[model samples]
Target: MRRNDHSINRAACYRSKIACLVFFAILWVAFYHAPAFAHKVTIFAWVDGDTIHTQSKFSGGKRVKGGPVAVLDSEGNELLEGKTDENGMFSFKIPQRTELKVVLKASMGHLAEWKIPAEEITGSGSESNTPETVEKASDKTSTGTGSESIKTDVEVLKPTIAGPGRKEIEEIIDASLDKKLAPIYDMLANTFDRGPGLTEIMGGIGYIIGLVGVALYFSNRRRKE
Candidate 1:
């Protein structure tokens, strides 16, 4: 009877060890694959004049890279459809002003939207206030006598006509901005994509160990009974 009891205890200990190992292995696998199974996406967008610019990213700052973008007017009609560039940016010029809704579809079911009010597109806010400032400046210049007014007007018109069109200047500015921002974007992507941190891994392991301990405690109690 003594020998038989010893054999039974040894068997129970072996079973408990195996159960704990199996539980930890399952936990590790679940943690490792969690990110891949999750659907996490976000988007940022803005309107500049008639053009709408957008960027889409995952939780880890991984750009949608290239994906379809749809522009809809307030009436729910599709105005334009295009794809994002490598930088996760896309722009479309609208024919007229209206409240706009831009939706990005990165993949099968991932979607994000940006709603731009009509006032924003029509320049009815701070943008509309700009002309008043210019008019006030013009009035001051006009008060400087006819000759000075003529000279000032000529100087302003010369740069407007001879230097570059508004569109060209805007493109050049956008290009320079993209160049400067590229590194920052890359850094964000790298930083976020590292996935589960040390704390998360440790916490998962702790949970598995605790669960195994509980299981063994109850199991040993049952064997004693």
Candidate 2:
């Protein structure tokens, strides 16, 4: 029964190939489990004074290291871009005061976005209306040449006064809070990127086993034929 021997040899060859493929697949999953379950991409952002900070992570709290990040304005125009650090964190001085959208591109085609409302963005826009309004008010008041008009100009100027000590105070407060809240921010990012639960992991394992069973069943069926 050389025919029988040939069929058996063919089946053995097929089994070997399947075994090799399965072994490599399992090895890959073991080595890259973080990115294997990386479908859940999360990004979080906050403004600290004039700077916007973002943190990104994949499933299992794996930092999205070296990933590209884009900062876009309200109109979807790219403002600036940067890459995440080892800590999955990136920071940039607040771009334009418009609403900002930060997009992170993680490994394996994963993407996450975070938005900062315009009101939360500090600093003036490209044009500061305060200076223009005061200039116009001063020009108008000077034409009158009266004490009342000068007093009105003073009132106009008072509102535009860039409270000098205010910025220093804000810097101090931000520095203090930055140190205190670093861990909290990390915790929140990790919590959001926790990915699947134990139940889901077990379900995945069961699915893999089902696949292996199906492969074995077909192989045996082919041999029977």
Candidate 3:
């Protein structure tokens, strides 16, 4: 009857392992807390010329009105602070030339961060927009500074055929593009707000069940042999 006893012991050991796995699976589901908190807050930011604009929203697409926005550098130093308006937007001039991190302090102790790469910013380090150059272009023909100092034929002739200066035209185009592209940026931000859905949770459960089934099958086959 030694073989019979051996099989019984093997069966008992396998049963214990299965019980532990089941216990752990239940705990896993219980402790699956990160995904829930991940969607609680989200912040998105974009650059418009010298200005950095941010949008903050809660989980259900509600705007975080009047929320405080803190701008931080890559090294975690606070650069500036501002508050969101009714539309949940906070804007500030580019403080300095480096990678920026925008943090949103929403109500109910919710916080989120958005990072803006340095390259995305138009200029760097106290560099202002080239209104001076635009002015020069406007006055170049008047000064008759001669073709020697003029870099190109376009600069020499730009003042003649323009209702607005070239810089103004560029500003207009950029504004138009930003308006058209705002919806797309918002769509992307919304995508990030989503966490795991029911399908993923169900799949995790099924995976645990299937793993236990496989273990049980191997244990049974070994015992039978």
Better of 2 and 3 by TM-score: 2
lDDT tens digits, residue span 1-225, model 3? 999999999999999999999999999999775322224777899876668888887777777778889999999999999988887888899888779999997766689999999877743222435677657756764567643343355457685653444555556667777778778877776676665689989999999999999999999999999
Model 3, runs deviating above 4 Å: 1-39, 107-109, 123-180, 207-225
How should the candidates be ordered by lDDT, best one leading? 3, 2, 1
- For each candidate in turn, the TM-score is 0.44, 0.54, 0.53
Q: In terms of lDDT, which candidate is strongest? A: 3
Q: Residue by residue across 1-225, what tens digits does model 1's lDDT show?
A: 999999999999999999999999999988673222126665666555446566766766666776788888888899888888777778777645778888877665777787878765655222334566657655664576853645665588784544443334345655565567666755553554455689999999999999999999999999999
In candidate 2 the C-alpha lDDT for residue 126 amounts to: 24
For model 1, what is the error of residue 90's alpha carbon versus the real structure, in angstroms, after optimal superposition?
1.1
Per-residue lDDT of model 2, residues 110-195, tens digit only: 78899888766743222323566556655664576653644565577685753323234345656777668767876676676556
Q: What's the best-to-worst order under TM-score?
A: 2, 3, 1
lDDT, each prediction = 0.68, 0.75, 0.77
Clashing pairs in 2: none
Name the weakest run of 10 consecutive residues (lDDT summed) in model 1: 33-42
Against the correct fold, how does model 1 do in TM-score? 0.44
